[model samples]
Target: MSPAVSPPDARLPHRDARRDAVVDELRRLMARVEGVPKGREGALSFGLSALDQHLPQGGLAFGTVHEISTASEADLPAAFGFLLALLARTPGSAPLLLVLASKKLARCGLPHGAGLAALGLAPSRLTLVETENAAEALWATEEAVRARAPAAVASAIGGKLDLKASQRLHYAAREAGVPLLLLRPGETESVATAATRWRIGAAPGAQDRFGLLAGWRWHANLERCRNGEPRAWMLEFDHATHRFSLAAAVADPSLARGGEAPSLRRTG
Candidate 1:
């Protein structure tokens, strides 16, 4: 009977099943890796361990657009300062182009040269462009990013950005291989194509070595990230160093003082 054909090699089916399982697992692993937003290769590091590790490519991705919005009018400076801090961390001497809507400028006033200098940004290195409205501001921003003349392009808009406009800016920034920073009002939150969305609010002010008021501190909420989890941290900007440092967590006032807690500022 030809030795019963060796029972059709029953173990062969089990071996084939195991091989298929291994192949399936490999495919799944590859899909997960590809799903991560790698940003641009050679991305700039934020220099803060807490923040950089959570960002795609282990840092802020160049050639992508990022959004920063304030929690209130009071938080505007913090948001602007945060953006400047990020720009300072970038590895280039190329000038930065700042586009502001006329309405926003009229309301928030112009950024002080001395304040920017304190943040390590030279006044001469900045070029300000005022536009009649948000639309024009966005257009100018796109042009600036497309030109790739500046190391970065930043725009301040007072209204919501539709998906179409956001997509246009995103594409332009990617094509030019430049970073784009968008500052929107606190209440203007809406869907957009930004690679990352940050909501910044004023945190407790930092104290000097003598325990006196020092530089500004901000609570940056990573509200949206393409391939990162949402996380929040208290960041202190050192004017002298032009670097951001993680702030120590604050203790609950009630727990520390055995009384009602001091009211904390609301942060979006």
Candidate 2:
């Protein structure tokens, strides 16, 4: 006679014991493979050289949930600056959906596509979605995440996301494997469901201001790294040639491991 089966649980479903055994065996067989699968991470490269180095494989992972929050107002750029660069490099830049709850982007246009059309990104690729409230915006943002084909999804929503909603979006983001750029509001101390959490602080400007000092600074911190610590760093975005790179600000022998660079840096 066949083995008797049990009923399913309310919270967690129960499957047949024999079926579970088969799944366990299959998992073990797969674990002994030569190497882990080199799954496709969304092609989200940073236009800035300095910023990409800190991310996974020169960019954020396509399949992971990334939370971007700011500790201070001045540091807000680090969170969105990276997103701007990612959008510029994401494949097929048109139809970029920007679901924003807060009015940061509404008030302050994206630096890449603002003041003038000099930047390569035309007005068409930049689509903005402003909702009536945070709840509506979050729903729309989740929908955008499911649409995954966009270069990137940047949403500046209020810091009132419930855990269940976050989990749903996180699952969708992981499944779709799209780069979700969430702009967490300032002074938010709530928990986040992100594979990586980074806090960015703007450094000084990169070029001379008519008759002033030069260069912009950014302090990036990998607050939560489910992967690994990797490396935490600050960068200098050189505007003369329009290139972003690691800062050589300190030269105390220990931190000067990169050696001397040419007098002038070439930017793109």
Q: Whose TM-score is greatest here?
A: 1
**Model 2 lDDT, residue 205, Cα:** 53
RMSD to the native, candidate 2? 14.0
Off by over 4 Å in 2: 1-39, 47-54, 103-112, 115-121, 208-215, 240-242, 250-268
lDDT of 2 by residue, 1-268 (tens): 3444544455233445657577556643442242212364343655555446445445666655677777576556565665554455557644777777765544555454662132234556778788978888888878887876665677777657778877877777766667777777684654366667766666665455585645556665556654334334555555444345666664132453332222112110
Model 2 C-alpha lDDT versus the unseen true structure: 0.59
Following a full C-alpha superposition, what root-mean-square deviation does model 1 have from the true structure?
10.1
| TM-scores of the models, in the order given | 0.77, 0.67
- Per-candidate clash tally: 0, 8
Q: Flag clash pairs in model 2.
A: 203-217, 204-216, 204-217, 205-215, 205-216, 206-215, 206-216, 207-215
Best-fitting candidate, scored by lDDT: 1
Per-residue accuracy of model 1 over 82-110 as CA lDDT, tens digit each? 88777766677888988878464367677
